[model samples]
Target chain A: MDIKNMQEAELKAAIKKVMQDNFGLSDIADDADFIKDLKIDSITRMELLLKLEDEFGVRVEDNDAQNMLSVDATAQLLKKIAG
Target chain B: MASKIVVTGLGWSTPFGCDLDQAFDALFNGKTATFRTQNINLDGLYCQVSAQIPRNEAIFPFEKWQKELPGNKASMFTIFGLEAAERALLDAKLIDQEGGYVDQNLKIGVVVGSGIGGLEDHFNTSQVILEKGANRVSAFYVPAALINLLPGHIAIRHKIKGPNQSQVAACSTGAIAIADGARMIVEGRCDIMVVGAGEASIGRLGIAGFCALRALASGYNDNPQQASRPFDKKRSGFVMGEGAGILILESEESAKRRGAKIYCEYLGAGLSNDAYHMTSPCADGAGAIAAISDALYWSKKTPNQVQYINAHATSTGLGDAAEMSAIKFIFGDCIEKNSFAVSSIKGAIGHMLGAAGSVEAVATILSLHKQKLLPTINLEEPDEFAYHNDKLINLVPNNGIEASLDCVMSTSFGFGGHNVALVFGRY
Candidate 1:
């Protein structure tokens, strides 16, 4: 449950699980753009961010949340916040 | 006569299944769809019986829709509405095999409604607001809770670029939507209309709310099938039902131009308000009488001309009695002489709330087409009021009957005293 102690691979897996649960996208690539590749609109993007905040037990600011457009970026942001 | 509005196709996602003929067959054979609720948790609720769509059988194409829209985030009613609309379009031969419109030039509109729009979604969103916070609410909450979104999503999927509207007249919503769709075509606003209603509010909150109103059937939780007994002496209350019914209405000229098979001519529609009670019909059944009279007047048919009546008898004692009184007032000697048959499919499929009227309209049109009067199942012993002047009015109790039919009427009475009567005749 603690994202702070989780490995990079584990964090990515967790993020992919969330994406799969929300959007039914099981083959989400780590570097795929949320909007362009996955077609997650702004509203769905906000919902996904909220889910991530809940899952990782952290807060995401508006500007940083907007910039977390890919699974890799989301993982990096979560790591920085966890630290 | 004015340019006719004709029904070209019909579709329904009902408790019996999506196949119209199969569902109507089940109704004709006196089968009941009511059963104890499994999907909805009803631990302390007074009414525990409901008639829900057979989800596995009536499947929606979620995968195809997910590619374009967030299908998983859409409300259940919206999904059911989409399925029904697709089936109707296919039945009407308006859509190609890939579910796209066959004719790109026709101006096709949509009008669908619901009694309580997305109550289940609203309940879930409220829980998020309570347990988590308002900021955690999903962005799809507002869109999912809106009634008009059902029609909006249908329009988006089919690329329909014409007049779109939603009716919200409680149980009369489906009938009103059909009437409004016909009006659109009559007024030259559109050539074809996909019109009906959908409802999927059979959740814990919906059941509890209706239970609080003392509007749902009870004491038959263990015998759910017999809970909806319209016109029977032991009839108590209605069983909650959920589904969608969609019909394709086209102008006669348009349908002829396309060589579409016409189901029946939409002779006329009558809409009125009781203005006496919000939930109860006027004591004299004046509202229902006026609506039926208006429809007959508009259709230019006398009471004796109607061969069958799909009565809005929702298995409730007061409602059934009031409708009988209205029918008697309108068709006095006709009832006494058994000139026409009357039946209520609610006894078989329960009251489908917003979808009830259109589904029943489908039954009515089919009765005219097939020349069959569907049975009011569970009517073992008809009530005393079902008889007039020592002659039993043909309630078509517990058995289907074949009759020569040319004209038929379907009646829908909703909460807020909304009453609608639609008359259909052979094309």
Candidate 2:
């Protein structure tokens, strides 16, 4: 699941699924920072990291949590973690 | 320092029964409603045993106000507390006889305590992340799971307008709820207050979490009654129980003016902390002593004046001994004698945690009226800490028999090192 390597359409769907699943938000705005805009508290973000690993079948390095700012940034980080 | 307060009404939802009188009767006759769980799937767990109340005991039917509350611990507790409060207010005769307990004239308040608020809510919501995704989560999840909302829901439904708050200190929550309501009465903040604690954490996450900490007993899966032995030598760990115990506290002046039936006087309360560990107490028992000593001080009575102590003895490895040492500190030279009637119903009800304090307070008040010591069952052999188990009961063979009761005290120590004690006596 290298989110960056995936085609544009597939990546959008995957990000959509991840945001919808992890955050429980019916709507995910494109410019949304997964942390700030969603109001996902620190614990939830850590939980998000765990979910990412569980869903993507990858190991999210500790440093990757902070770099996971925007939903787009999260999609890119999945590429790194997946590698 | 403050005006006198009286217990005008009482309510409880327990494994024994729904109403307070029924529960008390079942409790007195030594009937424990605990049974082995054949329902929920709890495979990888430390304690397969639980003291679950019958499902039918739910105060309100489905599609009631709880439908608006959502599926969570708060949803369950809100419903339970509402039923308890409804019964309590009605019993106090504050409401209309034709309708029920609802009086617009009453200046009422509510204090509902929760040990761990809505653990089930969070656990179920977390699953939405795995299954339906984030958007599938309930919008009302945050409000439904918040610990403070127990009182919030109660106040919203009943329109209680005085002091409203939630007390949380793990297991000691219920005891603090009563004391806080007492303070409100003494301060003249409200004429009447409905107070109690509730928890509904009996799920896969709850059992798994406790198992993770190794804090639940795994010994008596075959027989649930024998599972929780508080002061016994072979006592392993506490059995988790859930429910709510509510008491209506009113000023003596108010109760006297209204001619309400009185249960007992809410004398004094004490609170302290071990400040030692996150979950464990300091073996020296400094916090426990401070709480008991202060409660005695508030009552303006000597330890000798006390006749019974409904101890917060959870029957854990260190907790039971810590409580004994604290009692020794308060009773001093008196504890060695047949000093006071003392027992932990945790052996019977498995430890009610959040509701333990209020439920045990009800038990202590019953002792004052009935004048008999409640037994700590499941004790085959007493441990080093409690050799006086048999001697704990003074008025013999007359369980629930009325006798002279000067004063009694109840104690609760919770997580984050929170400690509280309440003293009561006849009006």
**TM-score, every prediction:** 0.96, 0.78
The sequence of per-residue lDDT tens digits that candidate 1 reaches over residues B1-427 is 2298899999888887777888888888888899998776789888998987765634345455565455346788887788788889988999875457546689789999988989998888899999998888887888888999999988877888788889999999999999999889988888899999999889999999889888899799989999999899888899989888999999999999999999999999988889988788886789999999999998999999998899999988788888888998888888766678889999888898998999899889988888889999888889988887777788899989889999999999999999999999999
Candidate 2 local lDDT, B117-153, one digit each (tens): 7887788889986896775565556877787887887
Per-prediction DockQ: 0.57, 0.03
Chain B, per-candidate TM-score: 0.96, 0.92
lDDT of candidate 2 vs native? 0.74
Where is model 2 more than 4 Å wrong at Cα?
Answer: A1-83, B57-74, B97-101, B336-339, B388-403
Docking class of 2: incorrect
Query: Which ranges of candidate 1 are over 4 A from the true structure?
Result: B57-72
